[model samples]
Target: MSEQKKKIERLTGVKGMNDILPADAPLWEFFEATVRSLLKSYGYQNIRTPIVEHTQLFTRGIGEVTDIVEKEMYSFTDALNGEKLTLRPENTAAVVRASIEHNLLYDGPKRLWYVGPMFRHERPQRGRYRQFHQVGVEALGFAGPDADAEIIMMCQRLWDDLGLTGIRLEINSLGQADERAAHRRELIAYLEQHADRLDEDGKRRLHTNPLRVLDTKNPAMQELVDNAPRLLDFLGEASLAHFEGLQRLLRENNIPHKINPRLVRGLDYYNLTVFEWVTDQLGSQGTVAGGGRYDPLVEQLGGKPAPSCGWAMGVERILELLKDAQRVPEPDGCDIYVVHQGEPARIRAFIAAERLRDAGLDVILHCSADGGPASFKSQMKRADASGAAYAVIIGDDEVAADNATVKPLRGAQAGDADAAGASQQQSVAFDALAEHLIERMTA
Candidate 1:
């Protein structure tokens, strides 16, 4: 036998799971920064919860009959202890659980937001992944229809901020629990009459989650589903007034929307106003963001009956749309790069970089992988590729003189770069490097 054992095969990431490469980091950062700013401006506080929660949190909060609990959840027994654990499929339930457990609403209403990864067992597609990121907003202790309207307004503002296009809003109210139950009785009766007309999946959900049957994409079942009983018709007076109030608010704000009777939201906890922003841009799986009032969810999850309204946007789907529409801007690289020659020059380059960074400038220090220094030509190429506007060159001569040669590598055009170098190139002293770079950048 050989003295060395065979190497183990390299393992790959799980299917439907993906790695966010360096190329995609810019867009992710831009999206996150924009959302964080927007949510904060509107009086929302950020909250975080663990990615894994007790499986019962979902089964109880999301509803036992829902598809999330029945099929899509990634649940397993904790190996150390026999406790059942699950990778949260949707975060709303977890958010509600945290709020209830912590009594966040005891002081009054709380406008909270969260951004994190969620897992689900589903077919991996262009915009869907087993491990995906979501930005969720929750407003608790507010029962007014105004709260629902404000949430939609926030959604529209976010789309505008992202410069996204082709998204259209559609809304429908689920009314009170009694109203939905009364409609369910009629809906089931109607579906039972035409049970043979439903698709296999539709038929399966018909008895358990008849509201979801309306969301089916099966062409053969569309005609029947379209003509099925709509919950909008059975709304009580209070429900109608609440729905009208939301409509009036959207109209006043000039936020366009269509009333979609089929928009019940995949979650069973939603009651009263439910809305979704969909786009034809994402192929057949069109919804990009959606949510509504889950008035009973807090109480259902063990809190004193507190009203809540919230929504979540899928990061991948929205990014896909922004990418397709060419709305995401190309990420700019560092503002400056320091390229050096001698060991002493490299040390000086490191000091210059830190000085620039301390001055609020982003700087990239160039180093060759071979442990030997790279030639000036090679360093220049790297500086240009790094998207740095200026390359501060510190050669043996410049290092000995205690100064650096500031070279402009990028400008509006090639000619501009040459012109900038001709006009701005200088041997900047060690202490003046940061000030010199700032002056050149502004100029």
Candidate 2:
């Protein structure tokens, strides 16, 4: 192989994909941890499914005409066998596939949640990546507007807890399949009247999925789209009642929302209530999370008929908003840094580090040796950079004496010699190190 080609191949990641470096991980952890706790409190049991699924799952689940299955999915055939597999474009299909294959709905309702990477071949931009992460929640069975409202409420709680502002809740109902079919015929007829003004993408979807045409971003087609037959106006008795019940529930609970007639889920399976959480803070791409009822997906995926409603939030986009709003906190690092000089001190430091770990403290052992122990000044610098609360300094004299120097690194408690402005050191016996750290950290 050419050296140039080999070097190029080794140095770069796939375009549009990204790595979450150490500094970026704390925000991700905070978001994931918060979502986990929220989901757990709402009685959601997490279910993990494969990243690769049969190609038909998405085609049949998300619809072949939708942008996901049509243009953006990453699908390929296995070399060993000819079976086609796809890196999931979105996880709803896979989640539903798993639920059906396992007969999760056989007995009754199941509230499930999952968080993972999803693949989509797309132009990368702010808040958008080819390989992105999402948090998906599916409340299978218990078909009611209550399920829809519950998911919305959970999303609200998440934003409130995260201290997010300017995130708007916009909702609409796609009605039932029959209502949508009727709407489609009317929408297509209306679009045909102004086909010359429709954008290329809009015209392409005119017949295949006319509802998405109403969701156009083209300025030239705004008037045309705005005047297009509204889906909300076509809702029948049951669909109207369901949407009304959802609105009533939200109002009773004091959750604010705007009825966006133009709002429609990109997925073909959605029916009844569809909602999106949007914010103007993120330029152009304003949607942070969205989903709606997909009642027939369970049966469509080869399981007995079941009604399901769910939503998925883009982790990157939400984090982007949090970052733009300056809400992401710096990651907390080790609780203690273990620094030692000389052989006896090194050995004692290792043992003490292990003890600290066993006591549930995070410790960064000053491990590199360029010929001898790192200088005390250098070790202290590393401890500060580690964001640690304390540094445990052991030297030959202290090791021989069975004692160590405990130094405060940051966030000094009042009245301590270090509290007013500077760090201070206190002598601590070897055995009391763990207890001292625990007490100090807790304080």
The C-alpha stretches of model 2 lying farther than 4 A from their native spots are 1-10, 369-372, 413-423
The C-alpha TM-scores of every prediction are 0.95, 0.94
Residue by residue across 1-443, what tens digits does model 1's lDDT show? 66898799999999989999889988899899999999999999999999999999999889888888888999999999999999999899999999989989989999999999999988999899999999999999999999999999999999999898789999999999899999999999999999889889988998889999999888898899889999999999999999999999999999999999988888888999999999998899999999999999998988899989999989999889878978776878899989998888888888888989999999999978898869999988999899988888999999889899987777653335353456446688989988988887888
Q: Any runs in candidate 1 off by more than 4 Å, and if so which?
A: 1-8, 412-424
Error of 2 at 42 (Å): 1.1
Give the lDDT of residue 377 in candidate 1.
90
lDDT of 2 by residue, 1-443 (tens): 65565444558789889989988998999999999999999999999999999999999999999999889999999999999999988888898899888888878999999999999988999989999999999999868999999999999999988888999999999999889888888888999999898888998998888888888888888898888899888889999999999999999999999999999988988999999999888888899999999998988989888899999999999998889778888888788999888888889999999999999999999987677557888988888888888899999889878999988877644226744665467889989989988997786
The lDDT per prediction is: 0.91, 0.90
Evaluated against the true structure, the overall lDDT of model 1 is 0.91
Q: After superposition, how far is residue 250 of candidate 1 from its true place, in Å?
A: 1.1
Candidate 2 global TM-score: 0.94
